[model samples]
Target: MSTAFDILVALGGLACAGIALVAGNRIGSVAAFVIMGFFVALAWVRLGAPDVALAEAAIGAGLTGALLLRSANRLGPVREAGVPIAVHGIAACLSLALAGGIVWAFATGTAEAVYPSLVAARVGESGVSNPVTAVLLNFRAWDTLLEVAVLVVALLLVSGLAPVRIAPAPPSELVLPFLRIVVPVAVLLAGHLLWKGATAPGGAFQAAALLTGGGLALALCGLLGAGRRTGHVLVLAGLGGLALFLAAALGAAILTGGLLDYPAGSAKVWIIAIESALTLSIAAMLVSLFLGPSEGVRDDR
Candidate 1:
């Protein structure tokens, strides 16, 4: 018998597909996507990974949907003409063949245990209980570090395209009180998360994202202004993490005859220090990207 979750997942995927086909130009698409996100979350729960589910909902569906909606508003509905019969037929046949092949492969494949044992064996040494986190930050740290650098580069490219002008919105009477209450609280929370990440679910990426949220809030409320577009601060902020990583590697080579090697008994300390710098740099780059070219700014009275 098909389980409730299986039914929900199938129904949600089908509904979203249908909505995209019929009313993709209208409001139905958004509704369909929201349903898709909810069903995906349910599937994550069924898979027994609530953390993945939370991230999938927060980032995959929620943030992506909001971005798409904003883009849709900016660029109105698109129109496409009907395709030629022969072309359509060929495309449909190709798509069906691909789908059939995928189904057949999965059906024929035998189940074999994989990955879990390997992860279990090494997870303790990696210093993280979460296998995914362990792999990301320890076993495959160089890859993850490069991924972060790519994000920084992308943000830099975006910032170059449109520099943020600090247009301070006039402060409402409640602004000061709100900032006073929230800024300190956010700082405290961010620091706690950063420190907790070593042995907990939280980490540099999550903590940086939270810090970026706070920075964005401050920018929106006109507490922070976009100052100079390109300066020593900006350049150093962009390169700080990379520089630190290279320095660590070189230092290791000089002291221990290996690159990127932490001294014995100091691995966690080194990792935390690198992550802290990365978190700050990432937060700064994200905020700068969001704010876009600065004109000479004046105080918002």
Candidate 2:
């Protein structure tokens, strides 16, 4: 049954990708792409990586689909000239070559590995019970810190573009009540994920995604304003994670004698604090990414 399920998921994912590529309409294509992301997430789960599956579903599929849909809506429908058959043929050949190379590499690679044992051996000193969390937040802190910086840079680039603001429709009676429930739930869930990350599959990225979703909901509902002032706040919030990480790195180097090396016996506290700050900063950056740099008013009515 497990093998059959895996086969089904693999086929479904392929089907979704094909549909997304061939769909005549942008909306249909985007929807199929999002479905493909879910299928890919399932494949990740089958591969025993729930954290990766969550990131793929939330960031790769959910938020990315939202961004694409927004762009599509803004651009409106327009027929485009199709690629030439020769161009398509060249592309197909290149893709096949790439696939063949990947297959060859995997077939030739050895299965020997030592990182797992090393991580496990030093897990006690890493301040987190979860090996994945310990590696990401401690052992591989530089990579994670740089990833945060990349997100900040992406937000800056996106916001630099002049925003297209569509005035939000007046909220109906049901909208406010829905926001009241969903926003709080998202916030609570994010916090839970952040805390559980120390011992489980959840972490800052997942928590940030949920919080960003909530912030987008509030912005759509006209509860959050977008303007120059708001943009400044967004910039600060977006960079806050990187700034905090850098400060921590320098401070740790001074006190602990190595960059990002937490003090012995207090690593858990430092990890939690950094993760908490990252959650907020990442959430704000994601929300700003969705909203763009449009000047807008908050409608409380």
Candidate 3:
């Protein structure tokens, strides 16, 4: 059954990916890509990586789909463009070669797995019950730190582009009440996910994505604006994680003699603090990415 399920997921994901690439309309392509993301998440779960599955669902599928849909709506409909038969043939051959190479590499690769055991042996020192969390927040903290920095850089680049805001649609009466309930629930869930991350398959990225989803809902309903002064709040929020993480890194280096090395028995506290800050920052950054440049006027009505 498990093998069959995995096969089904693989096929479904491939089908969706193909549809996404070849769909005649932007909306159709985006929808197909979203479905592909979900299928990929399922594949991750089947591979025994629930943490990856959650991230795939939240960031790869949900947040990315939302961004693509918004971009598609702003750009209007996609027009069909003809491709030269020779170009299409060349592209297909290159794609097949790439796919074949990837398959060969995976099939021939040595299954020497040392990292899992290393993580298990050192997890107690990492101050987190979850092995994945320990690896991300402790053993491989530099990677996570750089990931946050990448998000910060992406936001700066987007801001520099000075993209215009697509005037929001009229606020819907029904959405307001729905958002009131959903937004609070999203906040509560984000908090829970952040807290649970140390022991479970939840983490900053997933929690932040949920929080961003809530913020997007509010913005779409016109209850939030992207004005310059108001956007400063988001800018601060976006920087908070990186700032706090750097401070912690420097403090650790000074006190423990190594960067990101937490003092004995205090690793959990530091990791949790950083994750909390990152959750907020990531959410703010994502929302601001969707909002684009500020309109210089409040529109919370």
Q: Rate the local accuracy (lDDT) of all candidates.
A: 0.67, 0.88, 0.89
For residue 1, what is the lDDT in candidate 1?
A: 50
lDDT of 3 at 131: 95
Q: Model 1 — TM-score against the truth?
A: 0.72
After superposing candidate 3, which stretches have Cα over 4 Å from the reference? Answer: 76-90, 296-301
Candidate 1 per-residue lDDT, tens place, 43-79, comes to 8877877656655665456545654554455454566
Error of 2 at 209 (Å): 0.2
Best-to-worst order by lDDT is 3, 2, 1
Q: Which candidate wins on TM-score?
A: 2
Which parts of model 2 are misplaced by more than 4 Å?
Answer: 294-301
Q: How accurate locally is residue 266 in candidate 2, as Cα lDDT from 0 to 100? A: 95
Q: Pick the candidate with the highest lDDT.
A: 3
Model 1 pairs in collision: 163-292, 163-293, 164-291, 164-292, 164-293
Q: TM-score-based ranking, best first?
A: 2, 3, 1
> Between the candidate structures 2 and 3, which one is better when assessed by lDDT?
3
